[model samples]
Target: MRPVGLALIALAALIPLFWFAPLAASRDPVALFSQYLGTAALIVMGINQFLATRVPGLELVFGPLDRIYVLHKWLGIIAMVGLGLHDIIDADMDGLRGGPLADAAEDIGEVSLYGLLILVLASVITFIPYHLWKWSHRLIGVFFFMGAFHYFFIEKPFANADPLGLYVSAFCILGLVSYVWMSVLRPLAPRGHAYKVASVRHINGLTEVLLEPRGRGLKHVAGQFAFLSVMGGGLTEEHPFTLSAAPRDDRSLRFTIKDLGDYTSRLYRELKVGMEATVSGPYGNFSMPSGRDPQVWIAAGVGITPFLAFAQTLKHRESGPIKLYYCVRERGDIPYVADLQHLAEETGKLELMIVNSLEGVRLTPERIVEDLKGDLRNAHVFFCGPAPLRKTLKNSLVLKGLRASRFHFEEFQMRTGIGLGRLAVWLWDRGIYAIEKRRAEKTQPAE
Candidate 1:
């Protein structure tokens, strides 16, 4: 029922064609396979560039922008690994013609491979600062350009007229075009609706930015999100945030951003009213079901943003009985509590339930089913939360009477790594913290 990324599937399907052409040039399978890998890696790199462009209608193809990013990350890793193998395998054809251009291309190829390997390492090691990581990521296009040059000039088994050469050349062009569009052209001509900050509110460690359109505004479904770039207070990077408020007559937008990272913390401290902002999108399909079916909404922490938008819109739209569960660590952590409570009372079709985990209360599937009066046969369950909680609830609910399809969450966006990388980061953080504490203790005056 979910999108498996049609573009990725098509790439996989086309890979065998790379193997077919290079086989004629060499009887040794190792050399031929390496050539196939080189070509395939180029194609993957091209598509990877395309995916990073943040072009409209990509969510339709890739499911969600977050998922598209996830795919982009993996594809890049695969391309790097594939190219690494291709280089190491020594796929050079015997008695190939050489020249100054070929010699330069060979040297460039080596540099590009090592450069890509370093960039790939930077990507995998997630602890790097975002700005640095982003800057390093931009240099990938340079390497891609160099790699393209190397591909064309270097002595290889196939001629330029060959099918393999032509096919790989097409992808190289695609990558170059995408790179130019994103890095060179897109910045000069910005995308998205221009707006000025109408108001800024800090509540419960979250920054709520209200923006009013300077010209034409954005139109969006209640549950969709937008990428916002605040042009003032030293903030220029675009970050995705869900529109917490429903679309209004004035066409103003509201983004409830948590101060979780460096950019957000800076924005929270520095962003002011009347500062200009640009917002692009209305992306994602994570909206309410169209049909008037009973629904159970589960939200944890800041995951309540979309649900808040949904509740605000419920006055106009007709829907079946909806039981909304707001899960939080403590009472103070709940955002828009009074608004949600008012909405529940104002709309007789809605019910609000608060689950406080800090008070030793857990929102288990059993509790949800019990609250629903043991009927999940007809109710759709929509959730936004931590990945582990989602997994636990989904698996437990499916074990019960709830159908697997009925339990829906932004699975790709909420994915957790397989623990190893996360564990290493956790250990690294603890070690740094302990070292800092000991240093501070030594510097302190003793009685």
Candidate 2:
């Protein structure tokens, strides 16, 4: 997917250079560079919007949800660099540089550029509050429209009767159309049914939220997740959590959320029974395989959420031989093991292994290879853990003769806000987390 994504970006980047090279070379140096900058910026923005659509066809090529987001982040960074260069090189404020026609349009373009810089920055800044970041994220379309207007109206080569103009404008139009459909039309889009909290179970700093649909419910498979919004919780931001149980006819949903940050830590106290919420989605393709291939499943910490869904799913299927290694800091950190044990008994094809790192029984790639032994020959490795751990195993086990395609992993962490930016933003985010955590502590609901 990375190579494929790079190839697509290269195509978008090259269209303008190839199409307008003759004209640009014949123009002023400043003008040439400015046109290059503007074209590159808009092209990459178009690529970003295409990825945002989440079309199943495109996702099939993208492979994983996180990979698409990673591409989105890189495209945003590249577009920002282009916009910055355009602004720096084309800094004539008055109508003196461009014609009287472009003077006002150029200013509008500058305003859009500045707004975009802030929106891209907020995604990585983290401490700005998720809701604020998301709301600002929606402003991308407004600035994108402004940029498109600037491109079309500024009397540049793109405005002329060049294929370059039509080509770039096509992408801009497609991107804006996708944006309107996704961002503007999503709220009005009929997806899944509305849900309300039926119960909340507190367990070892994790909250098991059980929701029942108000009308019809979501049809979700095991190992898939949905975007959850708990209304009346003082925070209306939607967060993704895996469905902890298999699909049942009653349309019930379960999400075991670990208290990882300020937002999650506050969920238990703020959310009440019967609180209205929305569950819109059953996204992800990280379920069991169709073939009769032997499988190796790995789970770490809270990453086991998806695998729990898989386990419940296994109950109804003709289960195959499975080896699952659940790694945790300690035994107490492992949630829902009893359920897994019962699943093992019921399925008779599932084997559970617990690895407690604090007890010095660390889970390593070599250990996995040794344990699987002959089974490792053709077994498909499915990992639902931290990215670093998965990458490490991929490198180590691939050296030990693991097939790259057979090894699959899903990133449970949200990558929407991750991007290339100042290292200080991370520190600032941590500080914001500390302050918010303290505030959450101080404002704990009275028992």
Candidate 3:
């Protein structure tokens, strides 16, 4: 993420320099810089599409998908700011005011600009239900395609024989294609295998989604996730979930989902055996690194899912002295406790420590540092959990002389909640509790 993000930033910063710097003296400097800003924004938006595509070459090196999301967000913001500056400084309204044709074109451009602003803002708002936002966001394609028309027609270069126009036009075209591929084609894309539901097990308030692949199975490292869109139960949209087990020889995948939203909460009832779904991407870089030092693995709630995959990988490798701190709000929230415990015992050097937050086990970094055999700097610390827990632990550990490089974790933004201010809070809070309903005495075990 660092290298690719920085490169994109650099390119966004440099395009204006390379393209507009030479024309600065010949044209009105203000108008020239305004056009430059618009052009830079267009370039950034083009880059935006590529990043969103989840190309393995880029993501494998540049990101885990979470950081890419944050980066993708910032690029959109930068583009909007640039376009705003362009509109302000290059106000050609006086000319447009005199001509009806010019006025119509100018109005269209204004609409496109504002439309993009709303689209980007909608995405930033965590309160908006992801489903509504996901569908509405598709309208950006219309605005974007029209923007390309606006660009080609209004930019003096393309209509007036400027060579730089070609590149800008190319970017706009590419951006349009990318948006279509992602918004329309991706869900049905053949690269993602079709899977039939093998079983749905509701355990400890979480739904274990086990999928049996219909054809070629997804090849992924442990600790990775994929986007799954079930055809049944009104689940037409693709949602991301982590693979909880190492790739089974039978090629089945498991997702232990806690109801975090409208869709997930009902999945147990709606999704059933023989139902179909599409699986795209084996994304994320949450896997363990090569070296075997005294490793400290920490997990909170459902965040422990990835580490469960990692534990399976440990079976075949030369293992290290590892300590897993699995913390949950309560014991019932724990998923695969027996399996994870078995992995710990089987690994010989790995130990599992279950911390029930309900019972008052505080997982402070200071406590962790003291528990380990050597200096904190020597241990490779990998954490998976809620953002608050990761943040608190990371801050304390880094402050207490742990090398920042030794730490690893993904961003844990709560993104699944549906719609509006305090209502969003109400929905999300209950949505979580609703998923974690205590199982009844009469419920059957996994069949």
Candidate 4:
């Protein structure tokens, strides 16, 4: 899908360039022609922005889509440079440089110098990987408006001067309108629900926060997460955090976070009581089984957060026969240990196994399989942790002849960074393919 989107945008940009090639016999004509191409490029950018936000299920291609996003930024810079050259050749620089202060300002406004400046600034700010960049990028919303204003008000004159220009100008306006609708208005509309923090506690070198919906709502299932936006900060900057509390009728949500990066660290240090948060979620399908089938949840370090939710849900719902193999560096690294213990005591169907790597206690898949040699036959296994740990556990389980369908894992690393638009598009394409394949397989007659 990303390749298709990129190809479409590239075609839009190139079409104007190709149309102008025949007019290169006249320098003035060529300069004017390039301005039209620049306008087309802006329209392409608007289309890219629109598709990125509206599309869903993009995580699968996030790794490659990030490269496309870098290309998108550079393409914008190239368009701005081309427009600058076009203005230099077509418009009178002498007039722009020598006019009165008010005249110069008016000329500047006519050419979208302010819009270009804002675009450049927004692009630079986005390069910063910190949470500040997350907050600052909301200002890019202003750039879309500015670009539309520049297109409709300033370029419209050139557009009206010629039939070809008018056609391009009308299309640009339409694209800009679509971009604004999708990127700004739609996101701000009430779509998802909200949650309030029930409690904030420090455990196992992580901050555990419990949240519940502000009103009547369905509880989240185990292994699902919510996208949380802390108010007082910009609303556009939301991060996904796994739920650490079980699903229940009580209106409490929980998140266990370690101080790893800028956002989580600040969430631990700076979040206060009564801080309003918007939650868009309960996404993911990693849940324990409910029948007589045995299940195992393997977690490492703060990755135990989701497992805690599963355990709690199991305890409260009496959905049982579950085992947890939680590995941590030290006793202090075990998040919600006391809570897990309490839940285990309440639900005799739950077994808690703790492995401390820092205390010279190493756990290999072979050793784990050996410990539960007979128990491995009828169990589903779920794992959430660092890549290396997950890989080891997965290999161990596979060696024990566990079917692939019985293994569940959550990959949250793909959700990091600023290029969600590209990610969303990529995910949408993959999700469509997966759905189609599933439907085909389901409908096929058995051999």
Q: Pick the candidate with the highest lDDT.
A: 1
- Between candidates 2 and 4, the one scoring higher on lDDT is 2
lDDT digits (tens) for residues 1-447 of candidate 4: 246556666676666655555544543654456456456656655654543452345323332333344545555566566556655556321211221344443354444655665555555543456556544444554555555554444422233446555555665565566666755676768755666666778765588776667776545777777677777633335677787777766756777778777777778776766677777665655666667777777888878888887776664564536778888877444557788889888888778888888678776767656666667767788888876677777777787777766777776453233455567799999999999999999999999
lDDT per residue as tens, model 1, 1-447: 125675554665376565465466555567767877777888889888988887876776777776677777777888988899989997777767865699898889888999988987787676677779888989999999998888888887766668777878888898999999999999889589999999999989899999999888999988888888988777989878889999999899999988877889999999999898999897777788777878999999888999999999889988999999989987554788899999989988789999898898888888888888888788899998788888899898888888888887764242223355878889999999999999999999998
> Which candidate, 1 or 2, has the higher TM-score?
1
Steric clash count of candidate 4: 9
User: What root-mean-square deviation over C-alphas does model 2 reach?
Assistant: 9.4
Local accuracy of candidate 2 as per-residue lDDT tens digits, 305-409: 888888887767865688899988865546889999999899887899998888889788888888777566687888988777888988888888788888988
Clash totals for all models, in order? 0, 0, 2, 9
After superposition, which runs of candidate 1 have C-alpha atoms over 4 Å from their true positions?
Answer: 1-4, 7-9, 12-22, 331-333, 411-419, 422-447
Query: lDDT for every model?
Result: 0.83, 0.80, 0.77, 0.63
Model 1 lDDT, full chain set: 0.83
TM-score for candidate 4: 0.57
Give residue 377's error in model 2 in angstroms.
3.6
Q: What shift in Å separates residue 2 of candidate 2 from its native position after superposition?
A: 8.2
Candidate 3, after superposition: displacement of residue 257 in Å?
0.9
**Candidate achieving higher lDDT, 3 or 4:** 3
Q: Per-prediction RMSD in angstroms? A: 6.8, 9.4, 10.9, 14.6
